[model samples]
Target: MSTEQPMAMRQIVVSSAEDIRVERVPWPDAPGEHEVLVRSRLVGICGSDTHACAGKHPFIALPYRPGHEVVGVVGAVGPGVSDLAEGDRVVLEPNLVCGKCRQCRDGRYNICRELAVFGCQSVGAMADAFVIPRDRLHRVPDGVSDELAALVEPLATPVHAVRRAGVGPGSRVAVLGAGPIGLLCLVAARAAGAEVVVVTDVLKNKLERAQRLGADAALDAAAPDLVDQARRALGGGADEGADVVLDCVSGQSSMTQAIELVDKGGTVMVVGIAAGPTTIPLHLVQDREIAVIGSLMYVHDDVRRAIELLAGGAVAAEDLVTATFPLERAAEAFAASIAPDQLKVLVSVAGPG
Candidate 1:
């Protein structure tokens, strides 16, 4: 017999708040029925993962392995799996929903009663090997690099949010916060044939990036005449406003700005996660007939569309990968993720071995 040993799986486990360590763990065995074993290639660190690492997330407890935005290659498949085989590159749809729930039955699995995110709810994809249900894996099309594939999950969020707002051809959209999600929204909106795509942010660099990403107008959030500038950009004067306003920040101030910038009957899509509860102008929403919609994490369809968008060159996902770290430097990756200048931080996991 040849003298060769199998590679051990290295897992980046978060034992407690602000404590992340990479340890060599036993390699996972064969997948169960309807499950697939994935060799993680790249895992993006999300804001929620940071919050969980800091022990600030209400739902995520300590000792969590925080990794939801994951890209990997299939290594093994269970007997029940048919669509995917070994060597196929895929992106993990992190949301795990109970099929028997009412929300799942109604096709809104994002809000299933027993919904749990991959990294936040259970084990995350920060390991060299991950075994998950086959249905949660979406194939990455050809020509999409590993770095771009890592961003499919983040891009999927904005795709779902923009679609929820009914953004289509000729629609005017104003995105509050030129963060990753906001920038991706600009891409999605432009792909959807939006007439005017305006973005607002406090950071000039982010706004500049937004402009580079095809934003029609980039306005400073602290400017004295931001409202006037937004109105002029949308060609809505003072009375009319953008057809859709996306609150990618989701903080109190961003929500207020979203409500004020949208037209009377326009839709305000909330895509960001707020730290705590904040008061809203309920009277303004009711009187103006404004539809304030909340968009959670994406579904499987959004993941597929995001992959297609990245593959088709609709959005340059590589532009958001500002920093990268190896699996051994996962702590540094988490630290860099909170930096304002950093758009997306990815942890390089195991290769396609």
Candidate 2:
């Protein structure tokens, strides 16, 4: 008789606010049709993950596995999967959508009616190994390092927002909030050829970092005249605001500022997730003809462009990733990510393949 034990792996689960622990779980079964088994290498802690841990995120529930931004190596491929093979480095898109939905059929699967994120709503890639559909994996370029690959997921969101806002050569842009997403928006806007980009944040350190990352102006969000400051910095008068205002904070104050800071007929892209319902200036929106667009997660083309930006040196990973911890210390990593000074915190899952 032959006997063998099933493989086990460590997975991080957040049960409630400030409650996170690692549990040993059985390894995922072999990939079925069009599936691929991926061995996670690095995972980035997202702001939503922290919000869920703090019981603030409206979408993500408690007691969920927490790794959506992941870079991994393919371990095995199932039948019908031809493009990717074992040992290929890939990044997770994490969006699980229903193909029959209107949005999906229209090629906007990021907001599918039945959209469920892998880490937020289902089992995530925080484990040593995970099985996901082949279509959800984007092969990382050879020149991209593991750290840079891990950033593709986060960067994709900003890229999507910038594209939707129609940022282009000689465009004037203002980003509200200098966190990871905000800084990324700055980078994406600049890459899209924005003539001037102004970034705002309550944290002085974050503002300084933004200036170093090519922002034309980094203003203090708490300044009483922040609106005027941002407008002036964008080379516009008080009446002529920025061409596009990206509200990366998505709070009441930031959203209001976004509406006021955008030029007439310009766009106000809500790139961040609001913790709760907040009121906006509906009257101003109507009179100015401002398009208050809500940008959700990104589509596949956005991911491809994000990868290109990272691989082409448009987005520098070293400037963003501030701290890293081993998988065993994932809780510590989550803690570090919430630190006011930290930009991006990563958990080291497995070594580079």
Candidate 3:
């Protein structure tokens, strides 16, 4: 018996700055060769969505749908896709890399010259069904739940960031901003065997969540003695600072803090995007011999590793999920994502079908 909804799918589109509304869109069917048709199960509301909602994101065009942290079941597979079939629970890797770039040829596809991405650059996962090349889909292990599966995308960001910074044994890592990405960074750094994981933020509720997630210390970044707190919480002498500093927030001050907090020869990973020009101390960077690197969206392999982490129990997706909404209430979901108290907000689409 056919039980699918006969009506077309509903999608939220941004018509103008700060204006979002629901509109009807076609329901996608099975994809062509080298593609996959996924019935999205959960679509995460992200900070990028908030920026797009405000017309702040650089890549969002008018009247485009923008939810991309998606997990779903494979409803159909294109020709030559022997790796996946109908009824497989999976997570989609939003990056669509052109495999011919220098980075792609050299096995660094994350930095591919011509990368196609969902939500920000192309059609997003906020609809009932969407199609993409089979190269982006990752199969989850049997035990991983769909709720947790949706988080692989966000989780992959930190995993890639931490990997870029080489966070591992005996490393003292400080994560700026205790948002979901920061918290996820802490988790990844710890899993990489970092000796210290210190997360800082101005909000107590968020700091509390960080503590609950196994942070060694959660300091208030607004504290008058924040540097002292960070230095102490990081262990060793007052000036023996972090080996790696991760700035998960996109502000000029936070960028400065990221550079200042790391010790000589240490690496700084900027995972967040700032809205405007941010000053950097050129002389300090030169004298300190520090490496400042900006990390972009994760590669497909990182997404796969994120799924592996979920399956292996290295990080718990449930911990990051602060709230959820049905797909019909996507507006409310987006609103809650920007609220001061929420961590990760998700919209349920289709599950176990």
Candidate 4:
């Protein structure tokens, strides 16, 4: 007699801003070709998820499921999937790209003409069980815990931005935020051999965390002479500047600061999503020939590198996971994510398995 138990599923749905519901859902059937069934493990609550819950995210539609930073265990694989199998730990790449798009043809699928995200654009993995394409699942190394593995999605964003900025040995980098993305960016930059990393944030606690996470210096963005402080941290006087400045905050002021802090002809990478338009010094950008680059969400290779970084202990992902709630308390988890004290909040879907 078969010992397998009957399948069950539950999903958290965001009806609107401040309206979240947990409902019993029908168990998803076996996967189709090119798809795999995943038993959701841990889902990290990102700022975008909270914005989507508040109905404020620019791209996320209403009445959608809201989890993209997800980790799980593969429970079943369809006919076309030959690599993954039952009980394999995995993380989802989330980006669904149309292969025929011009960007995808050029291997830049993060900007595919017809791109859809898993949680934001389609079904999310904030459930007891979910189905995703085989290509979207990346196996997690055995040494990485489910919680840490869940962070690969968020970490991939900075990996792409750091790579785009061309961080190399002895490079000087300034990161203008200490939030999850900013902190991860610091880790990525340092791992890429950046010798001088100065991080600035409005909060002292975040700055302290940034220091612990390998930032050579942490400054308060609210200081009157914040630019001077950052420059000093970078070992540069007022006239000297960084080789690259990463605007992880991406606000009007932060973008302006990024421009001011980078050397002439240096690179400035915009990683964060601003609330709206932020005026900038276009004249200075033109005069100095600063390479202003905008990094989109990760491509497949970025995800692979994120996994490598996490597995190799380049980033202490678990240190950022300050809180976790059960699937039944997802709303509480979302609320906790916005709290000032929490760094990364995760929902325990199947409780570590």
Best model per TM-score: 2
The candidate, 2 or 3, that scores higher on lDDT is 2
- lDDT computed for candidate 2: 0.91
Give per-model TM-scores.
Answer: 0.95, 0.97, 0.95, 0.96
**Lowest lDDT 10-residue stretch of candidate 3:** 1-10
Please report, as a residue range, the 10-residue window in candidate 2 with the lowest summed lDDT: 1-10
RMSD of each: 2.2, 2.6, 2.1, 2.0
Q: Model 1's lDDT to the true fold?
A: 0.86
Query: Tens digit of lDDT per residue, candidate 1, span 1-353?
Result: 12132567688888654689987777787899999988888999887887788877777888887778888888888988999988899999989988998899988999999989999989888988789999898898888898988879998998999888999999999999988888999998887789999999999889999999989899999887787789899987778898999888888988888888899999999888877797789999999999998999888888888888888887666578899899999988988988888988999985523
Per-residue lDDT tens digits for candidate 2, residues 1-353, read 11122468889898875678888899788899999988899999999999998889999888899899999988888999999988899999999999898999999999999999999999898878899999999999998999999999999999999999999999999999999999999999999999999999999999999999999999999899999888889987768998999999999999989988999999999999999998999999999999999899899999999999999998778899999999888888888998997999999885321
Off by over 4 Å in 3: 1-7, 16-18, 350-353
Total backbone collisions for each predicted model? 0, 0, 0, 0
Give the C-alpha miss distance for residue 44 in model 3, angstroms: 0.5
Give candidate 1 regions above 4 Å deviation. Answer: 1-8, 15-17, 351-353
Per residue, candidate 3 scores C-alpha lDDT tens digits across 232-315 of 889957877789999988688787777778888888898876676788888878999999888887876678778888788876
Tell me the lDDT of candidate 3: 0.82
Which residue pairs come into collision in candidate 1?
none
